[model samples]
Target chain A: MKLQRELQIVNRLGLHARACAKLVKTANQFESDIVLRQNEHQADAKSIMGLMMLAATQGTRLTVITSGADAEDAMTQVQHLINNRFEEDE
Target chain B: MLSLSGTGIGRGIAIGRAIVLDQGHNDIPCYRISATALSGEIERFNHAVDAVRADLKRVQRNLPTDAPPETSAFIDVHLLMLDDPVISQQPVQTIQEQQQNAEWALKSHADTLIDFFEDIADPYLRSKKNDVAQVVGRIMGELAHSPGKQPSDLATLGSSLAEQIIVARDLTPADTIMLRGRNMAAFVTSLGGPISHTAILARSLGLPAIVGLHDVIDTIHNNDLLIVDAATGTVLVAPDEPLLAQFRELQQQHLRHQQRLTLLKSEKAVTQDGEAITLLANIELPEDIEGLRSAGAAGVGLYRTEFLFMNRPKPPSEDEQYQAYCHVLRRVEGPVTIRTLDLGADKQVDGGRPDRETTATSALGLRAIRLCLSEPSLFKPQLRAILRAAVHGDAQIMIPMLSSLRELEQSLALVGEVCAELEREAVAFNPKVPLGGMIEVPAAAVSADLFARKLDFLSIGTNDLIQYTLAIDRVDDSVNYLYDPLHPSVLRLIRTVIRAGHEADIPVSMCGEMAGDPAFTRLLLGLGLRHFSMEPSQLLEIRQQVRQSTLAGLSGQVTDILNCVETGSLYDLVDQLNQTDSD
Candidate 1:
């Protein structure tokens, strides 16, 4: 199932590289397979290298997908992560 | 002579030779399996791995115990990379397939990997390219037949061309260490910042370094003589006689001034009229304690606890926090005022949520005391550790972002709870440790009299107060022009806080960015503030400023300035004082 959510880029200098990799890493922790697509570019949520390639700017919109037994919960938790810019600002 | 310009991160000068490092090839073949050569290739790869591991251990053993733990952890990662079968096995397989030497195969594979990272647009991600390059460089060196010897060309120019080294790009800390024994005068890189490891190391070693000097490599030719003025961030090429003579004089003057500062470090920080003032040091790291002792700081006024939590993956354990606090207390003979964790939405811990609710206008939101109250689990351990460490010396606990009396009451209750727990556990601790609050918010400053009555002491944090009073984000470069510490409103707030604290007969001190600045030293002193906590670097300079003025004159002039509607330059005020001193 695909989940769409709006998250503000709260960290200084926007949602650049390292923060995106962190988001992807968190998403991969669940049993569910995850994918994050931003501005029409999709990447495997398990690879730090792949998520870094997205170059998600601060305040940019993103779409996330999760598939597995706990996909619903994973999507709900991951939504909080994306909306919080992976919590890098805090 | 070749010259390059860059941002000056550290202040100092050096003259040495240039040693240019080539970006070695990156692609290593995955499999090297000629049936005849397979056995030999495998043997060679194993030996290379063992050699890299030994080299890492040697570096780790030589590192100072007091050095940042990150330095040792970096070496550990390298060791793990060497042991990774995926990395080691692929190169041997490549060598067998291509029928090439193991060294050549590894270099090719590493080059390919580096090029892939170089194509990325993000600068932070791009910075990782250097880390990758370092791993490959070490592996390739290990596989090479002549492991320690420099290439023939570099060997020829070794000690003879000792001048300034201008790199085409940023150099890693490993690269800086390689040039240790050489007479390398200065470093000019195409890119970096004041906070980069290269800059920090250069400052620590007292090397003249300039970063972000674009096109420096192409502009300067080999064997060009250059003069690097680290203070002003200037590089002079082929200078005339007069210019060289001027620099020589300036250099001598700087050295003499430094010596004079050293002599004053032990003297009392008293005004001309014999009024004494307390001078303390504000530090971020444990290593900075040495600087405080050297600068003759009476005590540490503000020990920023945020740094302990900032870079780590999670909050430091209670034992870890206790050890660090105890170490500082034992080292410094004077009072150590430790501010409990001031983290809010702006600073996120590992696995923590980003403070999305905080806005440009939300200076008071989810920060300091507010964050601590909401996150008691995170705040309690630190409080317990600070309270436990107080038994070692004069340790005082300061709570950040206290806007109301109720917040103080609740915070005090938590402290009492921790004290009760310690008593039950039979832990030895100080029962009479003083408690204080930071007056950084305008609301806190406005009601300082009420706050002073409740707390034992008050430290004015001018940085946040100025930011909130003027409604400007100091970090935002676009709006930084408005981040003034000398604004009329800011001065008034400082005055109000000082008056409130003094009226209550409680000790008051200023321990923020404004305290470190020389320009504001007199203004703060004139406002009846006798205690200052600032960076170790500024102690002597501020001490000198303190000794030149009488309290009466400072107070009178400050009163006149406050009454005037027209604003005047802060520099003009300092200059007027200087003129009077000379007359």
Candidate 2:
């Protein structure tokens, strides 16, 4: 079973390199095939290189799709991270 | 002679022989290898990778745990990528299939990755090229069995180039970090910007460097006599003896000036008319006290307590703070003004990882007293510690960035409350510990009299005062040129603040970089500033300047110079004053 949720970026600095590292770290916590997408660009949430290609900016919405036994858990954590704005820019 | 212009790192100069460092990896030779040597080549590659990994791990271990996590993350990402099929496994497969040498195989994979990163749309991601290049450089370095140049060639010239200047096309941050321990005279690169990582590291290491000189590597050769005048961004190559001799004289004068300063370490910072000015030292770390004592300091004027709050998991407990304060108070017989935890933006207390690059607005952000006052829990523990330390000796409490009378009143009231708490706990402490505020902000300087009337003493923190007054970011290299202490407005403000303190019957002291500089010692004296606290390294030089100056009519001359300022021409007066004194 695959679970997916779309959320809008809220941090002041957006999905820059630091935020990408943070996203990658959180996504790797679960045993799920995670993919993040913005417009036509899609990246493996586990890869720093893949996420860098997404180039998601503030106000841009990203879809988080995970397919594995822990898909729901990965979705919850990544959504929580996105909602909190990466703890950047107050 | 050849001339080149570039972005200068700092205002420093160096004259030395040139040593070209061809750190660029584009020139590495690549060739097909025999099947018999394939496994040996692969083995060599693995050994090199392990060595580089060990080096990177050591760097990670050396970094302070509390350092901004990104710093460690930077190396960690590279380490992780090293295990990736793209970096670690791809090149090995390429070596077996293509019959290519290990160096060439690695380069082939790196080139493909570099092209991919370059094609990334975001400029931020595009900068990842440097990281890839650095990682590849290390691997190449391993294959070549040397870091900067081929080892076989370096064996002869390395010793000869020990006292040489490095001229390179460009330098990555990792390359500089790797070579930071080398005692090179200076660095002249063909590329950099003022606030770039390269420039920041150069400034921190106090290395004279100039960058962005197009074709610098092309124009200069090995062993060429190069004059790196970083102050002016001018590189003189094989200059005539007359010019070389002039620079040599200046260098000797610089050395002699240092000798003269050391001689003044034991002398009194007294005026010709016999007025004994109290010259103190500003200390940060506990070890600074040793130098302070050796320099014959009268006392510690500003004991910044920020060190206790930095690079830690949480804020120091009151007892921990008290112990550190007691250590300093025990060493100094003279009074030590313990400035409370100047926290908030620049200095983190909430365990936030330190950022590699300081944001432009951190100076104006909630930092120093602003951070402490807003977070009373942070402020109270430090206040309690300082109060407790007072029982050991003459320890005074000082508040930083007190912009308004209300802030000062609130801080003092808090101090009073802490003292009462100590009393209630039956703790022995100096209840009447002297309280003062740092007059750093322009508003504080303008309202100096109001503060002087209430506080025991006034200390002018000119570093921030100048920046705040001029609205210039001193750390920002572009506008930092305008951070002039001699600006007419700045001089007048210092004069007004000093005058206000005197009228209110308070002793005024200045603790800033300007206070330590020998050039401004006479001007500060002329402005009636009798108290000064500076770095231990500068204490002797300032003392020497103070001893040579006569108070008689000095104020009149300084006043005349202050009036002569016609916007940015204040340096002329400084030159004129120094010229007359030398004559």
Candidate 3:
């Protein structure tokens, strides 16, 4: 199964280093091939370096694409992280 | 012998071997690594990363368990980032693919990451790039450091290097404090402003330090004989046999002079003609009162209360300020003239923000009394604090940078209002606390009699007075050549203020650099200035001159010297005046 969901970056600092690390660390937990697409730019969701290279900031909309088994679960977890602002009050 | 010039912090001389310390972030040397050497380079890189991790872990362990969560969390973030492939793995890949050395590869990736961060629109994100680079730089520093030679701090040095002069790129306060027990001969930094914590720490420690050398770290090697003459901010890398002998003799002479000063500390600052001079200390902080008992100071003439209000988030509460003033007053036996908040004019209370502009009208800006009067809420607490502390010990109020009687009157009104409130609340305070005004402005100095009649006493802060009067910023090295303490016009002003204060039946004290200087001790004594307030370090030496000179003897000559017009003749006469006391 494959799942694709578009989400807006709600964290005040957006996908900065700290947030990117948390996002990548969370995505690395699943067996799904996860990629985050911002505008025309795309990054492997499990790679901190790749996610940071995306340079996503607050109000930036990102498309999350996940494939293989548990792809739906991967999308859900990522959506949760983004919605919680990576659990960062900032 | 080799000579290097830098900004000197204190006046002292030292002779020692140089210990070139690789402090803070140092640029790493870069070179190519052969394919055959790639594995070894990788191993070296891994070793450095491990070393950095271990160092951080040690620091983490040293932190108290009850330490702020943010501090531990900060360390945790760095530790997690170390494990991140971006910092640890990317550099290794660069080393292998580029066939470059570990240090260079690490820096290259770090720079790329930092640059990526810089492109981020958010300022907060951009600032985090420094943290990433610094963590990477730590590994780079470890790899670049020569084997068996760790960066030196006073704590790390063995007794053998006790006489070694500290040569560093820069220092943190923690690094400086750990330098005790080394009998540190001297300190020379490649970077620091005069008011930087490093320079101020060196001054307080009474260490010979020359800062802002630009390249002292690279030029001077470890164990090279170093001759540091802080009086001139000159660092001679190595001296010839004859020059070495000369420096050794000068070292002894410096020691002897120090001993003489210490011996003179017990003596009263009384002139040969039986006229007594009040020698008081001009302190900036409570910490500066460490050795007031043996400093031969009657009391603190100027407790610059600005330190409490500066580098802080907001104006200190009345009680917070009261405790700080009380801390100093209760420690000292004599009266402490607390100068109410002299902030602004280089010292701003923006919670330690970087300065934006000095080109703006800095010296003439709304600072000191002007700033206080503009914000009564800010001014009221400080006044109340001084009043409250006066109940504990001999405390007096001194306002700074007053140009007119209106400023004085307004300040008095605030103090009066605070006292009334304290009375209404039945809070104990000395309502009779002697209120004085600092005469640093030309206008105030000229109108000394009017201010004298209204105030209890007057202190001539010649440092600012001279700076303002001659239109020369005293701290500006370029224009400071015009900052002559012995200028005829300056002396005439000093004489005028002292005479004005006397005629008005008030005592005038000088609490500037000129007051403590032995060169002007007799000259000021002759001018009929009664009280002398200077740095605690300078009080004894000034007292030594006071006990030796006859004020009655020098008054006649001082009058003629004051009347001299020619600059050359005036300098000659002033030099002669100093000679008479020495003779």
Best by DockQ: 3
Q: Pick the candidate with the highest TM-score.
A: 3
Candidate 2 structure quality by residue, lDDT tens digits, B360-396:
3376877778767777887888888888888888987
lDDT for B321 (candidate 3) = 88
What TM-score would every model get versus the actual structure? 0.57, 0.60, 0.66
Specify the poorest-scoring 10-residue window by lDDT in model 3 chain B: B351-360
Between the candidate structures 1 and 3, which one is better when assessed by lDDT?
Answer: 3
Which segments of model 2 are wrong by more than 4 Å? A1-90, B1-108, B111-256, B348-361, B579-583
- Evaluation by TM-score, superior candidate among 1 and 2: 2
Best by lDDT: 3
Worst 10 residues of 2 chain B by lDDT: B147-156
Error of 3 at B75 (Å): 19
- DockQ (CA atoms), all models: 0.06, 0.13, 0.18
Pairs of colliding residues, candidate 2 = B68-B353, B68-B354
Tens digit of per-residue lDDT, candidate 1, span B1-583: 4456666754555443343344332233222234665566657766777777898899999999888966775575555445444356666777667765566666676666567668767676566557556766776666553322112222233553346554435554435434444556676665555434355445434467776666554454234345667777766655667777777777777678877888888999998889999999987578779889898999999998876775446678888899999999999989999998876544444422244333333455677788788878778888889888998889999988788889999999999998998899998878788999999889889989989998999999886788789887543434545766767788888999999988889999998767765667777888889999987767887888888767767787776556656556654664564445521
Score candidate 2 by TM-score against the native.
0.60
